[model samples]
Target: MTVPSSGLRSPEARRFLNDRLDWNLLRTFLVIGQEGSLSRAAARLHLSQPAISQALKRLEEQLQVSLVIRRGPRISLSSAGQEVLQIAAELYGTVSRLGPALEEPAETVTGRVHLLSISRIQSRCYDDFLARFHQDYPQVELEVDVLRSSDVISALLQKTASFGLSLCRTPQPRLEQRLVLQQRYAFFCGRRHRLFGRKHLNLADLQSENFVSFTSDQLGGNLSPLTVFRDQQGFTGRIVASSASLDEILRLVDCGFGIGCLPEHIVAADVQAGKMWRLPPGDGVSDVNVYLLWNREQKHTQAEALFLERFEHMLLTTELGERF
Candidate 1:
């Protein structure tokens, strides 16, 4: 049997991976070890003699553990090889049933799963996603929350949600992540503002204006995206107001409160509806990304697993892979 690499089995202190071990090779190993001959093992498996030998060789290379003693006609297992075979046989028992365990019975899908997001604009995806989730898993319930950027990590850690989405720039050991989209920040002014229809405004144009921003406590950093807004091409702006709520910020921006920094996706619809417009390219703030986060130790509940499965399929098939 092809034993998985492990600190206990290897000469070095490294853990084994599920992908590295080959089950078919282990079956060949078991047969070869039993018959004590390659030709005989090959006959039992109905494989070519060369195939039997190659399988054993690949296993040895992967484990960094020699598994056999070979001569022209005689074959025997090394002591280390014998130990591996015994351990591998036990591991094989579980590996064999893994497929059947997940096959599942055919029935209506039902389960409760929770999801959390960093911003309201991203959470908007859930309105349609949940309606569809219910159609598939009619009895399933999905709870969604929109929290600040920093709270996404905290929510996952505290087990308050099964999935989290946010702008996670650095890796955190406690969580696993999958990239959903890269975000670019944009500047927008209220429809009532004088610059509403103004185009081609340079960084210098924004230098003398006040801006609205996310509070540091909400953004999880010393500086908000305002840093990007204020420093673009050395343009400096005054902070007129700061709050964590995107909806409130957008409304205030609509009410002629102040110019603001926002994700393009967040303001795209409004821009399309002619409620707001983007500033000139070089003067624009940038550098933001959105990621899906979760704790690996606790996998998705049945409902969440199916939701993720469908969501992943949607991304794979659509051109909109970057945003969701």
Candidate 2:
């Protein structure tokens, strides 16, 4: 049934009329508009190309408007389609918010929250926050996947993850981000290394040293902390080993293969036990910002809100806060 464009005055009446529109059609329309191609939209929606085309046709018929202009394999929104797109986005956002806005009391909240986070965060702070959140809301399931920073953003964009924690900044306008923590990355060496116990060392002193480096892929071709430090210090060193695994990097450093750059928190225990030594000042090391990101289109459920609150509190009261 088509919702007539006239005589809907009350908010509830508008909502009722909106309910008459096929949400599947609207979703398909939005995806096609965003992707600008039926095949891409079909891939994203996991539907056949012809099915996506049919849904768009049906949506235009229901709305009584020519929503798109098709030329060969390309698609572009008509003026009317642009207006409809705006309205559809607003409607979709409103519908998403409805669940949390009308949710029951906090104690009764239940459902799973899927979270994607960088592996560094998983290693450093995941356990403390997960344990605390579980203690408060035992019935709410929390599913977490540790991925690279780029993968975290990808999962958020795909809507496969409700929330993301990333070590890199999210440049996408569609994602909302908040600064979660600041982590200091410093150079470290095994106790057996020549410069391990040095009180002070110039940047040039380490120019010819071999280094165990973190993989550059996680940063999406952007500079890593080590690269940034190298540029700033004009060091001409070669990476003797590189890996995506932080454990492997640490092990390589501990075995006296080369100096490794890592977050201070990850190596605090090793430093305290004299297994490794942090390089002194003048190394051009700096703190990197970590961000918590989520799609603005996603509504917060009561359980998700509670989890965020608890997680924020934990971060504020712990060593993460101190580092920040």
- Across residues 104-216, which tens digit of lDDT does each residue of candidate 1 receive? 54246677778787656564444565666576567777677888767878878887788887767566777866555656677888788878888768767877767777765
Estimate every model's Cα lDDT from 0 to 1.
0.68, 0.72
Clashing pairs in 2: none
Q: lDDT (0-100) at residue 318 of candidate 2?
A: 38
**Model 2, which residues run further than 4 Å from truth?**
1-107, 122-129, 217-225, 282-284, 300-302, 309-320
Error of 2 at 215 (Å): 1.1
Best by lDDT: 2
State how far residue 69 of model 2 sits from its true place (Å). 54
Q: How many residue-pair clashes does candidate 1 contain?
A: 1
**Residue 174, candidate 2: alpha-carbon lDDT:** 75
lDDT of model 1 at residue 321?
Answer: 32
Task: Tell me the tens digit of each residue's lDDT in model 2 across 1-29.
Answer: 34234334578766865777798787678
